[model samples]
Target chain A: MPVLHPEFWRLLSPEWVLVCFGTLFLLLSALPATRGAKRAIGVMALFGFAVVLVLCAQTLAALSPGMHVAALTGLDGQIGLTVDGFSQVFKFIFVLGALLTVLMSFKYLDVEKAWTGEYFTFLTFAVFGMMVMASGVDLLTLWVGLETMALSVYVLAAYMRRQEPSVEGATKYFLLGAFSSGLYLYGTSLIYGATGTVQLGAIRLALMDRLAHGGPAAVGFPLAAGLVILSVSLLFKAALVPFHWWTPDAYEGAATPITAFMSVAPKAAAFAMLLRIFVVGFLPLAPMWTGLLSLVAVLTMAWGNIAAMLQNNVKRMLAYSSIAHAGYALVGLVAAGRSQSNQGIAAVAFYLLVYAFMNLGAFGLVLYLQREGSAGDQMDDFDGLIQRSPLMAVLMIFFLLSLGGIPPMAGFLGKLMIFYSALDARLYLLVVVLAVTSVISLYYYFRVVYHMFLKEGAPNLPAPSAGRPLGWSLALCGVAVLAIGLYGQPFLHWASQAVLLGR
Target chain B: MTIGWILLSLMIALCALGVVLARSPISSAISLLIGFVGVAILYLALKAEFVAAVQILVYAGGILVLYLFGIMLTDNEALRLTRQTHLQAWPVFVLILVLFLAVGHKLYHSDYTPQQPDSLLMVTDQSQVQALQDRLAQEAAAARHATNPQRVARVLYGDYLYPFEAASVLLLVAVLGAVFLAKKEV
Candidate 1:
């Protein structure tokens, strides 16, 4: 028999809404129409995305109430899709971020005349990949989801082949991404060999038994942990410090909207996998890895923040900031791995939610400040931006400060929660390093403010270009940043109580 | 089955060599398809016929053809495959060699091989066969009411039908996508 639950059907078929709207987009894009129809399609996409967000919120609510929504109701052995509390939270973030990105793409699309059918098709398809990645139950599902997302992003990144930089960035990303995925698969194969299971819950059960009986001397257990960690593919997606060479190029080259989407979505999805693998599967080996990840966390923060301080290009700075944020999230994962409380995991989710808003808002501002000469996305371009468009300048300042973890903004609350969770778990060194790095981040982040309000612009800026679409598209996200920052305790509590939808 | 396995292995090796040695995109694509088919054959040999069929249909028929057609449409000429810079080649090759050696050593030492199943059913020993036959006869007489021989088939087909349907749907979408991508613009 069927699961007999409406919510189960909705959760299992989360991709339905996206696929439907995307097919509509593909068809409409193929047809000849004025720019009005194209813009309407973009609006329709945003509406469809809103539906996804609502569905995700409902799923989160159901999972938080500890409801058992059997994903594979009739399936004997294989697990289907489950929208657990954890997956629900990340899915909410992913869909919400993509919604904002699609909304922001409206202005860029209208401005660049690059609003083709392929653009929306790939974007919708990529968002589908992110949803799948966030909700995946097993290794094979996760791998397929990751590749689906990666292939779409590759095309999106190089969508403008006429632009030399775009082509270069896409080529480098594709080659390196393929290599890293191979390594990730190799690691997954090793873990499968050790555990004989691909499902996260099964892997956790197997690892717990191995650790319990064999203690520290269990060869297969530790090897499994290492392989599973490798299988998370953090180095490629999150751009862990050593594996971050592609970040600067890709971020600098892709269309502004694409860059914004890439920065938040893939990184957030990888963290989902990281949380599952570490907190659930490798909790037994926490002592060995927590210290190691703490060090990675510390170095990632220090290196990323310090590197940001030296970059004049806005995209490159944001790239480094993204790396720092990953470190921040990694700290939460490590604490969650070591602690009995779900606070750390909750903090990571909340941080991701807040990070998406701040990062996307900052990129949106970059899109706003764009002109013929400056084309935005440069520190110099923001010079005296308070004088040109005071509203956008203020918004830009808000985003940059939030990114720097300044108080009274979403980014500060995110950092506070993550650091507090770590401290609660007695991760003293990680907390201390995070504190120091937050201070370091302030220098580079303020440079944006310094350029916007402090420096004088060259007289040749050609006065912010016409036909710029500016309105409440990102206003919701901005309000989100403010509201979540001030009154975050409720979300935190709910996030902690959220359970996996799977059995 | 053994012959099939041997042939599949040979085909895979040949495809790998072709991938390395072929200069043109078409040849390389053909090699990829060949390798994909060989993998499907191996899957069939393992009694995973569904997976084998899907593998051939999806990877070989859909994805490889899409890639080949993409190459054909985008750049008709066979462009020169750029060689790696000589200065960097040695270091890269050495690194790859070291990696291969390390993996080889690990696989060599690891206790990962599955134990062979005992050949009790196939054994030619007269006493063992007679003993087995007597035990089977006694059990058969004791449990003469066995009525559900298709229990496993029922479970697999009836219970896990949705995911099976979903996989089919996913492949259908992929096919449509490849065609959409490969179709020439008017």
Candidate 2:
């Protein structure tokens, strides 16, 4: 029988509400009467996100604290989605990222003369797609979710169609993205052929059964090939090294708000999918993948930090920085794989939360600088901002410090947790790589600070006017970075509880 | 039957090569269409009648027409003149060959088989031929009663309902994207 019962719908209410709001945004965008009320539409989108956030939070709260059970939704013998703390935490992160993206886009879009209701529409759908990625337990369901998010972002990346670089970046992103999707589907088919099922739970059971009866040799080569291919696609989406060629160009070419959005939301979603698939589905093959992932983690950190130091453009630098940050999070994953505890997973979750705040805050400052004709993403644009706007420069400093993992900032605590987890797992080499790259990262991050505080401002340029929405977003992010850094125990506890729920 | 399979595979492979090697976009598209038809025939031979029909209807009939129109409308002269380089193709081909060889060696050595009854029965001992025939007869009866479309629909709407619904949303996003990108005005 079909699992279209009331409980299924209730459990899936967040996705339903998101889809409804996304459709409403689409319809409103199409209507000429609503065309002029772009800000109102944006507010409505924010309101929609707020409603879904509340719904997700309520579901999370309703789950008894420390419960290790997942509320799955699907027909008998064919479970596809699981609602649990892990999925909810990631969903909350995606919504928060989208919320901040909308707030940052208000003035940026208006200044660029690129305000369109469809922008919010695509943003809403992208979050919906991400929510699906977080919750989906079936390979096909996750693949569909991945495609939905990718398609929307591809369009959003080229949203400023009039710009040549925007179109060029989106085109390159689309071609590579399509190739990766093909790889994912191929991997999924291979795994299904090997295991006789697409559901993660079923795949695990089948793998366990095979391992028990025939030993390691029974696991088969196809499964190994499938795992490697699947990880390549996920790594590509997360913008890890070797598969991260598109990150710098795409980040630089897309509109600033979108760069911020894609940097946090989609990357977090990709990690969520990675954890779900590898930890839950392929746990039996942990020894194989953990070794593979550690190598990837080390390379991602080395290359990402080294490349960021070479970039003069703030956006591209942040792009490479985001890649390095992904590397740090991968360390958490590798730790999770090595150790017999949930600390590594919790560290990853907490780090992504901290990342979303400081990274968005940094990008928000960049957005604040964007004006009618000036893109304002160059290091020269930030020259002596303290003389003009002390508060903005100070706020930029906090964000930069946090991103560099300096003490007494949320980013520091995030890195510390990952460090502690790696140490716990006895991954000495990964720990060293993480620490050294973080220190190397500080130099590039502080370069912006150097220009902001020490150098002289351009004689012709005026002080950047921060809009109310942008200011609010920056203030929230700044407060989060500081608050989470100072008092991170409760958040860490929450992350650990969420990670345990997956077990 | 094996000879027919080999011949059909050769035809499909040659058409695929034609798609890549042909200079003009029109010929390349035509080659792709022939390739699609060859795959549909292969599907038909596998008794996946619904899949074969849909492959022809969707891929060959609809998408190939769109491709033809796109080729017709765009500047094909520029497409034809642009030299398509295979700078990294040789390395990628070698890597793929290595992978293929590894997989082939594994397949030859291992006793891996799909967890399906028909395939299991096919690989059973000669003494179980009577039981296999009975099982095949029973399966034939069941297949006749359900029909291909009914079985497909049963699984699509029952077991795979979530992904099916999600796929619709995916297609909607694609539509919105196409219109948003291609439209003359916001």
Candidate 3:
């Protein structure tokens, strides 16, 4: 357990910044006149993210390189929280993702015919949860953060109260999410019983010392069981293969910007938490967990890619694609686990950053196509997209190609680093699976590209009247995807430096 | 005391069985209520007064009423419990068996020591009776009882302050979501 610095409270300003802004937004929603100003509230939420981003940047700046704080210790040496380079990097990602989502939601919410006030509130709270998740060092604190995020997302999915599928999807998500939380809590108890502590840092030290010298063999079975249950809970949150049943329903049922937000922000937070737990805490027992995660990565990719190939609904397809993306990220995680190097963590972080852009851009286009009284997310909706709006077609081309791992798009570079690390770790079988899945993925992705360019039909969809705000956000993501694709070395270096210490 | 625990456990198990076996929603809710009471009693036996009170107040008092209300509002006379075929039952049973074995194996093999309370065990060892009584008296005298409620509050407000604040924001989000979804026009 680490002793608190003199300015330990100041280290938490970014999260409290979110909490204050969320409270203000909550109050803003309580009043009818203010709440009905949908655009204003959404913009306010973006401002909150901007403030948090600035605070995170400042915290990142203040901390010297290699200044890694161990878990915050409280009364009786119970762990409270932590702040490190990895956490700061993830905080930046969460705030940026929230900012982008809010920017996209400004017009999209009104267009979807949903009330806007609580949407912003829930979204901000969800962001807060992500931030909490990034910084949490203890299992209970992490669980609190996870539930906060999950609960908010459940409500967001059912925001379309009048829609039947939306309600059903929300119900399914809530039930499964709650079940997973129970499993997570049970795992926490098991770990506590085994190690006599909930501080992940302490648990790691205990396990390492025990491994170095002889200690009680009494804890091995429960610890292994606990790790399995805990990782299953996280894998469920990340939408990995066997635990991804709720993805399509929730993504399709929720409003589009939310689907984009869900695909990136929460997923990144879960991965960050996983990296912290597995790499920092469970690295000593790599043989126990690495095998299971590798198998999960392979199955997730296969199922996600194959199922995606069969979907006609674009949102549902992207949901499946998101699962496959998580699989790719998992490969990075497993490789990171295998090696002493931080390359795989860096690669996973970079992949999530690029994924946030391309995935959001794709969903942004879906929002553009959506008109009142129609979903506009069907496969046929994309017919003659090039002829109708060449600009959207081109942007969609950038995102779809990126998703397909085409070169000169950021997604390719993301996959390159992950594959490099996997090869470095000698995970040749996973590499083979990755190659095959990418090929299978190309067929579905270009199927969208195929729809836009080749399948000429009556341009009978709503005129691509996506408003100026939505267009600007899409352009930002588009420019990011392009720029990162071209010159990603700086971002790559930053990601490499952002690995958790005390490994 | 051991007998008391056994009886409460029996009530809980039976009530859980009723909750699954009862066909009507009302009966299920009733069984769930009984199960909750048994849980509260079990908590009390462990000397976790705060948790026992909360188990009764929140789970039995609030959530059960909510459940009954939902059942009443969605009342359907024609509704019947669907029967599972042997194939469906077999797979589920196998899964449950696997889970049971896994947990049971850990419980059996691991050094899981049951925590004793401040009260005495009613053992039939005449040779150790005087020592046992003296130990119980010493424990009773040494008990500087800080109740669970006070300890929880102290932890929540002292060491875990930020998480508590974050939890408030979580509740705010929950409230906002409830209004957003449940209301026809938010």
Candidate 4:
């Protein structure tokens, strides 16, 4: 018999916290008690996230010393839960985002009388899966974690099953998600055939070796096909031009809290994986993927901005804007392939962190403006927000400004970093395209600002019925956006450090 | 041995074509099973008996069963074949045909051919064993060498026993999840 080591459990501690919290929440919901039981679960989840935050901090320090710890050494010698700079920064983002989204959900759920323990449990599970994906260095492990998160989100999107849009959104998301996973699996098979290894690190070494010898191995049938398939799968996740059919529907149709979570958490996590795999696993083929990324980035930004201009729905506008932000993030990804990989990656990390807060804050306001029974995301719902509630108007202005990349807001700084990184890579054409697209994007983002601040109050529109507690949550998100924008240097430094760690 | 391998490859290709050309989804799915069987046979011909067995068990049995269940649950509207309403269908088809031609032209010009390894399994004989032992000792001398035939056996036997058992546990979890998800709430 094999003797178990103490460190094995230590390494798996992060995953354990998520599982325990999820199970406990499930049990609490099943038994049920006072109103505070639901509130207590949220508090417990916050506490659990605090613990994970501390654990991740420790791991980050260990990783700073350039530690390379191989997991399951006795068995398969797998690479589990790597703690490089890439993962360290993303783990922070994932945990922080989950905590905030849950807080926002607390207010929204309580008001809707839909506060269920299973909801928090599923959120924890999905967050845990994202963490796993961030650290995954093997193809199979990454795929499994990705599907786990997708499955949970599918159910969460349709949490309000009686609502038609919720059900339709969930079904569409599931069908497309399953199809993407299939493409990913097919890619994995092709990669395995080309390299005879499923481990990312091993595959990199094999591919590097093949390229060194200028022979048949350098370019071949299955290798190109595999790379194309993998790009398609990642494209689906990133919601680039051709693969973005699901984003608007899924975002607009799901519950407000769930939509808020979807807009930030999963998108960031997906980009994290894409960065690792493309920048590390496929580093040898930078010349190939860089050009492809540039083209897609241009198309996505252009199309996403143009599409948002036509949308009358607030949620749909945010959805298209999210796609545009993805294009902006791809600029950083393209720069990662150039001479300054660290700068490009750092830019992406910073952009995602800012995006998580701004998007979530915008959605929080949507939740507040929602009528008692209807989905809280119609454009007309924001009519005369300045008259109905000056505070909400100010918050909405802050969010839209941040999203529009206006100066003195967090979104501006994020855009500054990405555009500068692309220019540093000497990508002249891409820089011009991104700049023009950002101008086009300004039109749509300001449209909401126009409606909220300038338009006259609707005579028939009722005042927002959400109490003081929910208002405070929105206020907090708004303050966070301003603070992060004004005092973003510290965060930017940390993100840059994380990028260096990936190198 | 080459002729046998060629014959098995032909069989697999034929079955794969059958999978694509079959009318009904059920028949197409069944043809895929036949293609999988042919792939397993090819694996055997290549002397990868372990991989061959796994291909049959996992792909042919487990995954195929999942697909069949999925098809069974899908409604007729989703399954129906309807004529295209979009005006761009013809253009899209033409584009695909042109793309196929480009790919076919590239493939026809290329000189690439499959280079089959002599055997997937190393022949076990006294001299062969001695030669393997010598290579193993040399590799053991240098720490850079990853694994040998013997160490793989030891680790799989010793340290991996729990995970092997845990895989079965996972299978159980999957079965329960499938049943629970399919059941209507009381």
lDDT against the true structure, each candidate = 0.72, 0.85, 0.80, 0.73
Q: How well is each residue in B48-94 modelled by candidate 3, as lDDT tens digits?
A: 79889999999999999998888778735745634334668888899
Docking category of candidate 2: acceptable
Interface RMSD of each: 12.0, 9.0, 12.4, 9.8
Q: Best candidate per lDDT, number?
A: 2
The stretch of ten residues in a row with the least summed lDDT in candidate 4 chain A is A72-81
Q: TM per model?
A: 0.81, 0.91, 0.87, 0.83
Query: How high a TM-score does candidate 4 get?
Result: 0.83
Estimate, for each residue in A260-371, the C-alpha lDDT of model 3 and write its tens digit: 8999999999998899888866776675578779989999999999999999999999999999999999999999888767889989989998999999999988888887
Candidate 2 lDDT over B1-186, as tens digits, reads 999999999999999999989999889999999999999999999888999999999999999999999998999889988957889999999998996687546433544332322321212344454553475466557767897888788668766777788888899999999999999875
Q: How many backbone collisions does model 4 have?
A: 0
Kindly list the per-residue Cα lDDT of model 2 for residues A1-503, writing each as its tens digit.
Answer: 32556656666788899999999989988877543587788889889988988887776776655442323532113457777778888888899899988889888878987778889989988988998898888899899999999999999999988898889888989999999999999899899989877877667657766766886678888887887889899999999998999999999999999999999999999999999888777766666678779989999999999999999999999999999999999999988876767888899999999999999999999999898887889999999899989999999999999999998999999999999999999999999999999999999999999999899997867889989999999999999999999999988886775553234
Q: Which digits, one per residue and each the tens of the lDDT, describe model 1 over residues A85-196?
A: 7777787888877888887787677667766666777677777777766666666666666776777777778766667888799889988887877877777777887877
What alpha-carbon RMSD in Å does predicted model 3 have with respect to the real structure?
8.0
lDDT of 4 by residue, B1-186 (tens): 888888878888887887766656677789889889988887777666767788999999999999899878876455546423679979999997896566434433443322221211112234753654475466456523443434444434443433333233234333433443343530
Q: Stretches of candidate 4 above 4 Å error? A: A1-12, A30-39, A67-77, A215-217, A467-472, A500-502, B1-25, B46-51, B54-90, B93-186
Better of 1 and 4 by lDDT: 4
lDDT of 2 at A250: 91
